[model samples]
Target: MITENTIAAISTPLGRGGIAVIRVSGKDAIAIAERVFRSSHGGEVRKFPSHTVHHGLVVAPNSQEPLDEVMLTVFRAPNSYTGEDVVEISCHGGVFVSQKVLEAVLEAGARLADPGEFTKRAFLNGKIDLVQAEAVADLIQASTERSHQEAFQQLRGGLSDQINAVRNSLVDMLALMELELDFSQEDVEFLDRQEIEERLRRSIEELDKLIASYQRGRFLREGAKITIVGRPNVGKSSLLNALLGMERAIVDETPGTTRDAIETQLDIKGVLFRVIDTAGLRQAKNRIEKKGIAITEFHIEDADVVLFLLDASEGVTRADEKIWQQVERLSQKRREMFPAKIIIVGNKIDLGNQLTKGSFDPEMGKWPLVLVSAKTLTGIPQLNETIFKAVFDERWERGDAVITNVRHLQALQKARQHLGFALETLKQGLSTEFAVVDIKGALEQLGAIVGQTTPEEVLDRIFEQFCIGK
Candidate 1:
C-alpha cells in the first residue's frame, strides 16, 4: 500500500458542546498521537492494543504542561477508514480546547488535513468508489428522510455495483469480439452477430430507464418551485403561511397585505418544495404594487408547478375568468416551450353556499382541482398529499437502479446513444474495426460513472465538496 504523511483535523462541528473529536490518519497517526499523549497508566501508548480506547492527557512537548485531558482511540493499518493507521482524540468541547489540542498535534509533527482528504484517501485505497464517495457528501446534506435513505443506499455501493455490472458485461463481449477480429484467417466465431445485437438493445433499454429517473431525482435533491398566483385578497398569503407551518408571510384582513413574493421551503413525503407566495394578481394603483405584480408574473412563468388559487367564496367572477384565461394562455405557451404541469387550487371552501362543484371550467381537461380553507386547514392535508403525488412521486420501482447525479446521468445517456450507433453499425455489416470503436466509446462512458477512466480534475472537484472529517 502507498503510505502517506499523517493528517489531523477537528472532526466535530465548531461550537461549545460537551465533547469534540479530533481525527488523525496516515502512516504515523498513532506515533504522532503517542508523542503528545500520556496514558493514565504512565506506560508506552504504542504498546496499547488496536481498536481500544485509553484515558490520556495531551501535554506540551517543550514544557510538559497539560494541554487538555482526552480519551484516545487507535485503529491499525488496513482496518481503518483510510486503510491506514488512525487515531481519534475526544477532548473537552470548546473552541479553545480544540485549537490547543490541534496546535499541540501539529507541533508534534502532523499536518492539518485538507477538506475531504480522509475520504479521498478512502477512495484511493479501494475502500469505496467515486459514487460511494459522492454519496457521503449527499448523505450529510440530505434534508429529508427519503433523500437520506437514497444517499445511504448509494453510499453502501448500491449504485456502484449496478454500473460496474453493466460495464463488466460490455467488457466481456468486446474482448470476445476483438479476439475474433485478430484471428480473421480462421473461421472462429467469437460473438454471434444477432445475439450481440440483442444484448446491446437490452442494455440500452435498461440505461434509458436509469437516465429517465434523474428527472424525479433532481427535484428530490433540489426543491421544486410552486408559485401561488391569484387576484388580490384570495388568501394567497394565508395559503403560503399554512403550507410553511410558520408565519413567514404577513396575513391580515385586508387586500394586498403581501406586496412582495415571499418564499419558504416545505417538505412533503420527504420531497422539498420552494413555495412562493406572490403578490395577488390584480390591477395596481401604486408603483410598489405594480412592481410586485410584475414579479409575481415572472415567478408564474418560471414555476415548476403553478398553484393557481381561485376564491371559491366569490364563485368565479369576471376577474377570476380573466385570471384563468391568462393562466391558460401561459400554460399553452409553456407546453410549446417544454412539458409544463400545473395544479388549480380553490380556496375558502369553509364559506357555505359558494363555488358549487363544476361551476367554472378552464376548458383544459384534467386540470386538477382542490378545495381548501387556508384558515381552517380543512383541506390542506388533502391538497398537500395530492400535490406530492402529482409532482414528486413518479412511482419508481423499489429495487430498480436510478442515476441521481446529473453528471452520471449525462454520461449514461451519451453511452446509450453510442450503443445505438454500434447497433446500426453491426446491422450495416460495417468493418469489425469500425464496430469496435463505437463499442469502446460506449465502454469509456460507462467507466466514467465509477471513476475507472475518469479525469483527475473531475475527481478533485467531486471530492472537494466533502468535509474534512469524512
Candidate 2:
C-alpha cells in the first residue's frame, strides 16, 4: 500500500565501499533529516533550496552526540524519485556507520520501507507506467550489452508508447460502438462492420510481430543454456576450458575424471549463453558414474541447445551413436515444451585433416555438425558462430520494441486471443454488440499491461520481486 509516512532505508548494497547512502522520503523527509543533521556551513537543511548538497554531521536526536560526518542532498516534492520530498545521506562506507545513520533517521520519524516501495510510489503517483517500472528491475539485472539496451529502451517509453497507442485505438472503437447502441432506436450505424474488422486485423498482426520477438528477448533477458554432452574422455572438459578461455573444468587424459556438470557463462556478440560441461554419457561402470550421467540427462532435457561431442579421430563410435539415440528419444518427449536443438560436435580435428567439412555425412543424420580441437583451440570461432546461429533466427534483425517481460507476453497473448474472436465475429456479420464484448475484453487485458485496470494482488506480486530500498 502507498503510505503517507516518511520512509527510510539503506539504499546502497551492504558491503565495505568508499561510500554508502541512506535514503529518506515522504512529506516530512526534509524535516526528519534536519533533526539529526547539523550542516558544516551553519544553516538549517529545511531552508536550503532543492537540489543542494550540504556537508553535515549525523547526531543523536536526544543528546546531539556526533556519530559521523556526512553529505546530505535534498530533492523537494513533485520532482523527487518517489514524487515526494527525498533526502539522501552519504556517510562513511562502513556497515556499522551506515546503520547508525539510518537508525537516527528512523528514530526521528520514518518507517522502514518495504521492497520496491519507492518505485511503487512512483507508479501510483503517475511518474511512470507499470511497464517502465518493471524495466527498472530489468535494467538492474541485465547481464549483457544487448539485454541492457532492450531494458533501457523500455524504460525510456519505447515500448510503452506503442502499447498506449494500441489501447487508444481500441478505446475509440469501443466508444463508437457503445454510442451507436445508445441511439439505436433511430436505426443508425456509427461505424461499418467492415471497417472494425480491418482495424482489428491490423491490431492482431501487430501483436503477432511482438509475440514472435520473445525468443530473442528471452535470450537477451535470461541467458541461453547450452549443455555439452558426450561419451567418456571425448574432450568435453577440454572444450569447456577452451570456450571460456580459462581452466574452469578439470581436464585429465583418464576417462571419467569429471563426475558432474560444470557450468559457466560465455558472452558471444552481446548474447549471453550459460555453457554446461557434463559427465560422459555411457553405461555407468559404478554408482557414482551413474549418478553423474543422470545429472547430465536432466540438464539436456532443459537446455536450449545441446552440443553432442564426439572424438573426430575415432570417427563416430558406437557409444556416440547410443547417446544420439537417447537424445532423439528425449527430443520427442519434450517436443511441445522447449525442444532442445542438437548440434553434433566432432572434437580433436587437429589430429588429422579428415573432417574439413564437418561431415560424417550419411553416418549421422541431418544434424548440423562442427569440427574442432579443444586442445589446440582450432575451429573455436566457427563453433561459437554455429551455436549463435542455431538458436537466433532472422526475426532478431528487426528494430521493433521487444516483449521481454513474461507478464507483458501473457497480456499480449490474451489480448490477441480476444481480438481474434472479435474479428471472427465481425466477419460473420454478427451484431456490433457481440463483437463489442470481446473488444472490451481485449481492452481490459491491454490496460493491465500498463496498470490502468490491474488488481491489487497483481501489483503486490510485481513489486515483491524488487530489493528493499529499490
Candidate 3:
C-alpha cells in the first residue's frame, strides 16, 4: 500500500495568517525535504526523529539560497496522517511565503498533491476506512456545532463501528447458511431455522435504526427549511425578526408589505434552521403580488416545517379560514412528496388575551398551538422549544452516531433491502442458496460503506469532494 512518489501542498488555507503549513508525504518525503531544508542544528531532515520538530531554513537545491525560515516536523513511516514518511513545514503566513516553500519542496523532488490525495492515500494504505475518510471532509465543512460534533464522532469510528457490528452479524449468519447449504442433500440441519430468522431480524432492526436517523442527521448536517406563512398583517415578519433576534424583515402596518420571501439562518440549540418569511397569503392585487404569492406557496411545498401565524388579538377570521383550507389542500396534495410539519402559532398575545376557545383552540391538541407576542418577545422561548421538538427526538444525545452522509444513507438503504429479502426468503422456507444470495448482497453493500469492497470510481468521487492537502 506504499505510494511511489512524494506529494506536497500547502495544508493550511491560502491567506495572510500567523503561520501556514506545507505537508509532504509518501516514501520520498523525508529525502525530498532534506534536499531543501537546512536545520538550525546543521542536521539533515532524514536524521530527525519521528514526531520531532526542528527549526530550519528552506533553501534552493541548485544554488544555496534561503527561501524561508520554518519549523519542520517529521513523522516517520506508518506514523503520519497519510501513513507515509511525512514532513510538515510551518512557515510564516503570507501568500508568497507559503507558495515559495511549496515550490521549494516540489523543486526538491515531491510532486504537487492532488485534491484530497492525502486522505485518499490514508484510505488506500489501510489507515482509515471509507466512512472515516468521508468524515474528514464532513469535519472540515461543518458549519454548526451539531454538525461538527457528528463529524467528529464519525471520524472517531462511531458510525463505522455500528455498521461493522451489523456486518459481522450478517457474516456470521451467512457462514451458518452456507454451512447448511453444503449439507442440502441430507435431512440434517446444521443451523436452526428460527435462529437464522432471529439473526436476520436483529440485523434488519439495526439497519432500520440507522436509516431512521438520516432525517435528523441530514437536518443537522444541512439546516432545516422553516417557512412562516399567514394572511397579511398577521405579524409573520415580526415573528421572523423575533426568532432571529434582529430586524431582518420589514414590519409595516400596510398589508402585503412583504411580497417576496425573505430568508435567513438561525441556530437553535446547536441545530441550524433556515427560516423563510414569505409574502402573506391573499388575493393578489397586481401581477407582481401574484408572483410573490406563488413563490410563498412554493416555499410552503418545500418547507420542512410551516409556522402558520394567526393574530391572537383578532381571533380566527373568515380570511384565516380560507387560508387554512388552502393549506389543507396543499398538505393533502403533497403528503407523499413534501411531508412538512405545520405548527399553528397565535401571535400578538401581548395585545390582550383575545383568543377564545373556537375552531383553533389551544386545548384541541390538533396541531401544536404556541402563543407568542412577537412585539414584546414573549413566549419566544416556548416557540423555539416547540420547533426543536418537532424535528428532533428528546432522547437523542450529542454523541450518538447519526448517518449524516448521503452516501452512507444510500448504502444503508441498499443493505436494508437485501436484509429484508434474505429474511423473506428464510421465512418462506426457500432454499439456503437463495437466502445466501441475498445475505451476500447485504454483506457487500455494508462492506462498501466501510471500504471493504467499494468500487474505485465511488472512492474517487467521494474523495474528489475534498479540498487539496486534506
Candidate whose lDDT is highest: 3
User: lDDT score, residue 298, model 3?
Assistant: 86
Candidate 2 structure quality by residue, lDDT tens digits, 174-215:
999999988889988988888888889889988887877776
lDDT of 1 by residue, 345-384 (tens): 8898888536644676737336678889998888899889
TM-score of 3: 0.95
The stretch of ten residues in a row with the least summed lDDT in candidate 1 is 331-340
Candidate 3 displacement at residue 398 in angstroms = 3.2
| Candidate 1 segments exceeding 4 Å error | 1-3, 283-287, 321-340, 352-363
Worst 10 residues of 3 by lDDT: 356-365
Residue-wise lDDT of candidate 3 within 244-263, one digit each (tens)? 99999999999999989999
lDDT of 1: 0.82
Give candidate 3's whole-model lDDT.
0.88
Model 2 misplacement above 4 A: 335-338, 353-365
TM-score of each: 0.92, 0.94, 0.95
